[model samples]
Target chain A: MHILLVEDDLQLGSAIQRALERLAYTVTWLRDGQSAIAGLADGSADLVLLDLGLPRRDGLEVLREARRQKVATPVIVMTARDSVEARVSGLDAGADDYLVKPFHLDELAARIRSVTRRHHGVAANRLEVGTISMDLATAEVSYRGERLELTRREFALLQALMERAGHIVRREALENSIYGLDTVVGRGALEVLMHSLRRKLGADAVQTVRGFGYMMPREPA
Target chain B: MHILLVEDDLQLGSAIQRALERLAYTVTWLRDGQSAIAGLADGSADLVLLDLGLPRRDGLEVLREARRQKVATPVIVMTARDSVEARVSGLDAGADDYLVKPFHLDELAARIRSVTRRHHGVAANRLEVGTISMDLATAEVSYRGERLELTRREFALLQALMERAGHIVRREALENSIYGLDTVVGRGALEVLMHSLRRKLGADAVQTVRGFGYMMPREPA
Candidate 1:
C-alpha cells in the first residue's frame, strides 16, 4: 500500500511515516497541503493522510480543490480539533476518515485498511490467480495449497503481474512498479525479476510480449 | 492492497480477480451494486473497481449512496460503455477514474497506481524517511547517500517501516504486511525477517518494540 502523508509537524510526520512503512505501506511525505496537491496532480499515491494545520494551504481547501478537479483519491483528515462539527465538515468536504492528534497508530492503520478496502470494493483479504492463491495480509502465495517461496522482488513482480493478469504490462511500467521512482535501475533488472518469477510461478504462468511487455493469461478453470 | 471488484459478469469478475492477484492485490468479487454497497459498508477493501453496468443497484447510484453515507473509500469505475457521457457521469456521480472495457491490465494497473497516488496526496512512487530513502519504481534503498543491499523480505519490511516511520506497528500487522493474511506462517517468521532486516540496515537502524512490534526511527542528518 502507498500513502501520502501531509503534515507540518516534523516530529509527527516522521513518526507516522515510520509507523506506516513498518506495515509495508509506501509513503510520500509532504510538509504542506500545496505540495500534497501537487503530488495529487502528479498521480501516484494510493491514499492520503492530511493534517488540517498546514502551511500554504489548509487540508480542507486542498480536499475541496482536489474534488473540484475531479481527483477522487481517498483522503483521511488528521487534526488537533476533534469537534463533531469539524469531523462533519471534513467528511462533507470529502475526507474519507478523520483522526485526531494523540490518536493510536493501530486505529489509523485499521481505518486506512478499511478505507482502502471500501475504495477497492474488496470483501475479503485473499486474492487468487490461476492455481496460485495469495493472502494479502500475510504475503503468502500458494498453488493447490502448496506454497512457493518467492523472493521479495519476485513477490512484488508477481503481485504487479497478478494485478494486471491477462493484460500486458510494458517493461518500463513494470520496472517502475517494482523499483519505484527514485532508484535508477538497469535495463535488465525486470528481465531478471521476471525470470525468477517464472521459475516460482511455474512455466506458462507469465507470457513475454517480445518488445512490448509481459502478460499472465487467465488460467482455464 | 485489497480490492472490491464489482462486475456483474461472472467470467470477467473471476478473470479480473485473477489478474489483480498476479499484481499482488487482494480482490473480493461482487456481482452487483447492492453487494458492493454492502461490502463498502462493511469496510473491507483497500479500493474498489466498480462496474457501472451493475445489477441490483446502478453503479452511479451506489456511488451517491456511499458518499451520502460518508463512505470515503476510493472508487475506480469500469465499464463496457466507453462513451464520454459515461465517463463524465461516473466521475460526477463519485467514481474516481473511469476505465473502458478492453483496457490493458497494465493500463488498469497504472490507473490504479495513478488514482492511488492522487488519493494519498503524495508522490506515487518514492519512500523517504529521515536520511533513508527507497523508491518503489526503481528498487533502491539508501541511507545517508550510501546504497543498501536488502533481501526481498528485508526490503519489504524496511519499506513498510519507512512508510509509517515513527509509528509502532503491531507484530501481527507487520507479519501480515510481510507474509500476507492467509499464509499460516510460523511464530518465528517475523523475528527472522526482522533480524535480517536489521542486519542489512546497519546497527540501530530498526528498534524492537518488545511485545508490540518494530519501529524505524528517524536518522539525524
Candidate 2:
C-alpha cells in the first residue's frame, strides 16, 4: 500500500516512515500542510495521516480546501488534544478518525485496518478478482475455484497486476512492483509471467496495452 | 466495515457515499476535519477517506493533530490537483496513499484494498483457530486441513468465532455478524451451531464466555 504521511517533526516522520516501510508499505513523508495539500491535489496516496500542527498552511485548512474541491479520499485526524469537544469538532469537520497524542503504533495500525475495511467493505484477508483469488498469507492464487500453480516470479507479477487490476498499469510501475525499486529484472520476464498467467487463467484474463503495461480485465457481466 | 468519509462538496460527497454503499461498504460522511476527528476519537470508524480541502480545518492540520495525539487509523487523501510536489508533501505529512481526482471508483476501490492490505497485513480468508480453518467463501471448515462439511448456519456461526480467535467475541457482535440487524435468531440456534462446529472442529474449538459471548482459542504455537 502507498501512504502519504504528513508530519513536521523530522524524527517522528522518519520513524513512522521506516516502520511502515518495514511492513512492506510504500510511504511518502512531508513536513508541512502546504505540501500535504499539494500532495492531496496530485493524487497517488492510498491514505492520508494528517497532522493538525503544520507549517505554511494549517492541516485543517488543507482538508477544508480539499473537500471543497471534491477530493473524496479518506483522512484520519491526529492531534494532541484529548478533549471531547476537540474530538467532536474534528469528526464534525470531516475527519474520519481521531487519535490523541501518545498512542501505540500497533493500535494505529489496527485503526488503519478498521478504516480501510470500512471504506472497502468486507475487510477479508484475501483478494478476489473475477475467477482469480490471491491469498496474502500463503501468497497463493486460485483461478476458477482451482489452484493455479505459479512460480515465484510469475506469482509476484500476477500479484502486482491483481493488486492494481483494472487500471492501465504503467510498464515501469509493474516492473517496480515485482522487482522492487532497487532491483532490475531481465528482459522478457514480465512477458513470461503474462504468458504463464494466460496459459493458466485462459488467454483473455489479462490484457496487454503494448508499450504501456497490462490490465487484468474484469469478468463479463 | 465502517468508513468515515470527509468530503465537503455535497454533490460529490453524496455521490461517492452512494457508490461506496452500492459496493456494500458502510460509510459515514463528514464535511470537515473537526467532525472527522470526532468520529475517530469515538473509535467508530474503521478507516477514513479524507479530502485535503475543507471549510474550516484543512486535511494536513487534521492529520498533524491526529498524529500528534497518536490516532493511528489509516487515511487516504483524494484531490483534483496533480503535482509531484503535492505527492511528496502529502507523503511527508502522513497520508497513506494520495489519489488524484477524476479517478474511477473501481480504481479507488482497489486502492482502498491495497491500503488495507498494507496496513493490516492481510487477514486470512480462511481463519485457522485451533484445529479448524473456516473458509469464508465456501463456508466450509477444515480440520487439520481436511475439509469438514457444515450447514450454512453452522458455518456462519463458526466463521464469526474464528475471525477473532484468541479473543472473546461478544454474543451481540456474533449475532450481528451472523444474522442481519433486522433478523431475529433463537438462543437455541447459537447452541446448535456451536455443537456442530465443535463436532466438526473439536470439543475445545469454542468456549462459551459467560454472560458475554464465545471465545475461539488460537492455534497452539
Q: Which candidate leads the pack in lDDT?
A: 1
Model 2 per-residue lDDT tens digits across residues B104-192:
55446656765665555563445677667664422445788786656656766776666567888777666655564345788776777
lDDT of 2 at B73: 73
lDDT of each: 0.74, 0.70
Error of 1 at A12 (Å): 3.2
Worst 10 residues of 2 chain B by lDDT: B132-141
Q: Considering every candidate listed, which one attains the maximal DockQ?
A: 2
Q: Please state the CAPRI-style docking class of candidate 2.
A: incorrect
**Model 1 DockQ class:** incorrect
Q: TM-score of chain A for each candidate?
A: 0.81, 0.69
Write one digit per residue (lDDT tens) for candidate 1, span A87-167: 998999999888988899888977887787788786435667888887656667897689877766676677667766766
lDDT score of residue B133 within candidate 1: 85
Question: True-contact fraction for model 2?
Answer: 0.07
| lDDT measured at residue B180 in model 1 versus the true structure, 0 to 100 | 48
For residues B1-221, what per-residue lDDT tens digits would candidate 1 score against the true structure? 88988888886677678767755688899898888889998877879999888778998899889867878788888888957567556665666677888665545766787777666654566778877888665456787898776665676677667766777766765665565433568979888888777676676788888889877776531
What stretches of model 2 exceed 4 Å from their correct place?
A121-125, A130-132, A135-160, A163-206, A217-221, B1-221
**Looking at candidate 1, what TM-score does chain B attain?**
0.56
